[model samples]
Target: MSSATVTTHTDDWVRHLLFDRGFLASMKGESIKVYLTMLTACGGEPDRSVTISLRSIQDATNLSCPTVIDSLNRLEELGLVVPTMRKSGRVKTYYIPGVPPEN
Candidate 1:
């Protein structure tokens, strides 16, 4: 039998969330899922933000609307995700922090 190799790169923000903040041990699985989905959307960059809809998140995570909302709220409470409302006041952009820029 042949085994497939799995390769992955760990970003600073991911490390911060998992190790520094100990979120993997403290946070709910749904919250972690939502946080990761947002990070993937933004390419895990603190400088870049993702403008995504709640429906999209629900679709991606296969989570209910209420569950997704609750997860987002939890992430916000932990200061892991920052959300800003657009001028339209209808759309929100999410920013993931904790990753410092490279020198």
Candidate 2:
């Protein structure tokens, strides 16, 4: 008997926090976009540190830089996203907690 090994790719999967009542009730659409961009916009990797760029977030959410900043501030204020000192070159990153898969 011969058995073939299978390797499944997880690079296409991303994780994010659930939009529960309290979270949804509190966050605006812009803020939500920011949340989602952080969640799935980055390359689906296992790293807890999300190394996404502002341009990437803006492109994913179709929001202006100022709007994205506003949303990030709101998310940070509400403890949805935590900015870390970690930086990939000049880009900033966030440390996600218990983030789930998005696809």
Candidate 3:
């Protein structure tokens, strides 16, 4: 038995749950990009908080701050993301709840 086997065969059931809840429907281009970025931070703990700054998302998505802000607002309106105060006393932090990996 190898450690890699356990890792590779890990049963990630989050995808099925996301599908049941309609998160897959929102997986489009930019939306999917941002959602994946946040979900990656979840590290299989989908229920945990996935916080990322606007600048980080902007860099990853190659989108301007305003564009990212608009997209985030849209996601917030859809109840996918919630805005929260940052612990570092800097810009606002975004919390992506139960974010699903891109399709």
Candidate 4:
């Protein structure tokens, strides 16, 4: 017989997103995909912030530009993701909820 071990980090927000019936049920598939992609990009940083371009998100999720934009909007509306910075020609910074912004 063989045994396998698994390690996991405690991310209550992720748990809520995955197991909370009301919240999980309210999310669209594309929105979930985008959120997960952003989480991967952030990699559990303390601030949970990621500066990524729309093209990068599209490439990561294999979603169209418009679709990615819509998903971002949905995430923002749901208070799951917040845009920390936006510039005319620069990648936007998004912060996942549950972390206080550094001052």
**lDDT per prediction?**
0.78, 0.68, 0.64, 0.78
Question: Which scores higher on lDDT, 1 or 3?
Answer: 1
User: In order, how many clashes per candidate?
Assistant: 0, 2, 0, 0
lDDT of 1 at 17: 56
TM-score for each of the candidates = 0.75, 0.65, 0.62, 0.78
Using TM-score, give the best candidate's number: 4
At residue 34, what lDDT does model 3 achieve?
A: 70
The digit string of per-residue lDDT tens for model 2 on 30-83 reads: 987787677664443344668677888888899998998889889887766778
Q: Write the per-residue lDDT of candidate 1 for residues 25-76, one digit (tens) a residue.
A: 7679999899889888987666567898888899899999899989999988
lDDT of 3: 0.64
Worst 10 residues of 2 by lDDT: 11-20
Give per-residue lDDT, candidate 1, residue 2: 100
Model 1 segments more than 4 A misplaced:
1-10, 86-90, 99-103
Q: Model 3: what TM-score?
A: 0.62
lDDT for model 1 = 0.78
TM-score of 4: 0.78
